[model samples]
Target chain A: MATFAVDKTKNTIRLTAMPKVLQGLTVITVLGLIVTLYLGYFNAGTDIQQGEIQRIFYIHMPTFFGAFTAFGATVLGGMLYLAKRDDKWDRLAVAGVEVGLALALINLITGSIWARPIWNTWWTWDPRLTSAAIMALTYAAYLMLRSGIDNLQTRRRFASVYGILAFSTVILTLVIIRIRPDTIHPVVIGASPQNAQGSFEATRGVVLALLPSLLFYSTIVPITLMWYRIRLENMLDVLEQKKIALLSEG
Target chain B: MNTPFFSVVMAIIRKDLQAELRSRELVATMLLFALLSVLAFSFALELDRLAREEVVSGVLWVTVIFASLLGLNRSMSIERENDSIDAMLLTPIPRSAIFVGKLVGNYLFTATVGIALLPLMTILYNINMLNLWVIATLLLGTLGICITGTLLAAMTVQTRAREALLPIVMLPVVLPILLAAVKATTGIINNAPVSDWQTWPQVLLIVDIIYLVLCLLMFSYVIEE
Candidate 1:
């Protein structure tokens, strides 16, 4: 059993134990990640053109979806925080940003690695790449601005609004390949742009390997990470309140 | 008695304009900054006539964006220092009216700087930046920038970092506007056919409307006590 309670007198949150669900989810996520990696490395068929470097695609594309899931939690958390004025929702929103940024970084690194052999460069200023870079920066700015404010309520309110607005960058990153005809980034699901480089068909082996990776990344990874982050934040709150209490007593 | 929405908006706008006219501080700083940036770009790039035509659109938008950031930070900090925002919130007029008023004032000042940059850029870059399409793109782009900037500046002004925080947060949000504006300006300057570049301005218009509606709806929440 887990205990998460707010003590009004001390003005702090007490979270005594990790929830069973979170622990179970963590185990499942770790196991799922390994299985997905194995499937990606061993089970998936090699691309006739690109060879083994293409294996990074399984991690590359799904981590973006992972980022998508995390940032979506941010938008939902932000909206709910604003409507209900709940600090827990605000915690969820910040957790979303931190997790989302990590996943987005993974997506970028994997893409860069994959691009070296496929696109023949470590990076390009394609629309998808530029937007993804900007998307990461936007959320990073969210964390910076959130820290600059000291007032709890005001910080929550402003962060909620900023978090909600930052989702626009995510949406733009996801759709830029579709809209920009000049991009050379590959599109796996639908028709690649006439100029797209390293485009590939999503064959059965590709789908079989990608589906579980996508499922684990988009669902379990972000959720498990965010749960731990939120718990850590609650502990930090308790520490902050204790410091304030000590100062007042002194 | 209920204050009419338009009248309230107009009154706030009038108040900001009147204050600006008396001091002439905001526009003067932004205009001076805009001029200096153009000069800096020209000296730094050292581009010949052909190269200038390719890069001048980017220079124009970048200058405008930085100038707008200066004006927005100044405008919002002024409100914060004087506690005028609180007084405005106390009034019965709609909260969004305050946003619209500040947006209009910021837009006008930034747009003036943008328009004035046209002839100077033409002279400096040796390209005809006085085209109608370029001016339209300028207006549409600035409106979108001001919409997001005003909302963001309000939040940043309350933070410890103040002016420095505004650009960090606002820049990425308004990047699509910057890209579209630069593209449109580049196309028009090069005299490209409408089929090639019309989509950029249309994108600018759509993004402007979306930001406008979003800022209006979100303004009251940001300013709440």
Candidate 2:
């Protein structure tokens, strides 16, 4: 059961925050770094060919994997909202889009920086990049769709539906581009599907470092969503009361 | 047995078609807008005997998707502008039936334009676009678009920004089908063999099934509010 504490003297309401939320995020971030550093500096020795640029992999891959996890959350939140009619799920969907968008942007930038040293070109519409762009564009549109709808319930419902369906496009944009014979981007690097599919031979040491980062990123995403949801709920409450007061005065 | 369910389905379809026939204004506007879209693309790019196959596929699909938005907006608006959606809700018919009915209406309206475009595009581009595979992909792609579009249209119908918000909500989700359709379509136009598409056709089929089934199940809750 949820317990709420209200003080008459101060006119304040306090609720116990989920304590594990912060712990989990911190652990994940710390672990993510350890893994990244381990792969870059320690367990995996410098590659015979690409030295410093190879180090960026630690940052590039995890953020994207994390971004995919975040996009997947929108799909799940979308499904739950459709099933339950809960606004919590809707807020989670929006939060996932925002989180995923940030990470995807990072992933894209890191890849481009890495590409300049390796591919001799800063940009390639490789399957994965294409897919990422499409995914970001779709969710970005999801946000736009929500903004255009003034009615709260309708916005959530429509965006939830659109959110789930949009994820499907990521497949075509990313996967097809990867599979197409004409694509120029390397598979294992930032833009290729083959490399992403099974390219990195992650040592046991690398996995230990990376898994925590994944755990960390995933854990914080929901908390970020929950905080947003609460704020929205509070705004909604204030609006409703104002409406009722106006109705009574008239 | 194709019992009362099918009849109920037919009746719903008939009602929509009849209403559209009486008010031909909606389809006429959409068709006109679609043709003009084609005109713009033709003049802007000067699609001709020498135009590339990839451009042909891209132009045809783009026109279809935009025209779809037109049909979807007008069709769903019919319910929201009048008290028709509320009236339909009060009936004993299943919510899925209403969804299916709307899906069919949107499909027919959009597909009519799609069917016409293949020949029209062929004549303009000076290519034989009467390929069965391209036609099949178009049909599947349109089916996915309508299924997803109807649910979004229903939800958007109640919003303050009705027509304006439909494409914003739709294009991103509809992209995969569009991508696959465009690719397979180009391959067909370029005379690439069956060997070209090992799984593209399969992908389109899966997309259609997923969108239709998910929309069917979730549509009831969307309209409930």
Highest-scoring model, lDDT: 1
lDDT of each: 0.92, 0.74
Fraction of true contacts kept, per model?
Answer: 0.78, 0.68
Provide the TM-score for each candidate, comma-separated: 0.95, 0.84
Q: Worst lDDT window (10 residues) for model 1 chain A?
A: A3-12
- Model 2, range B70-183, lDDT digits (tens) per residue? 889888888878878888889877888889988898898888889888888788777789988888888988898898899988877777677887887788778777877888
Model 1 per-residue lDDT tens digits across residues A55-160: 9999999999999999999999999998998789999999999999999999999999999989889988888899999999999999999999999899999999
Best by DockQ: 1
Scoring model 1 with DockQ, what do you get? 0.81
Record all residue pairs in model 2 with backbone atoms less than 3 Å apart, i.e. clashing.
Answer: A28-A216, A35-A209, A187-A192, A187-A195, A188-A195
- Pairs that collide, model 1: none
DockQ of each: 0.81, 0.59
Docking quality tier of model 1: high
Clashes of each: 0, 5
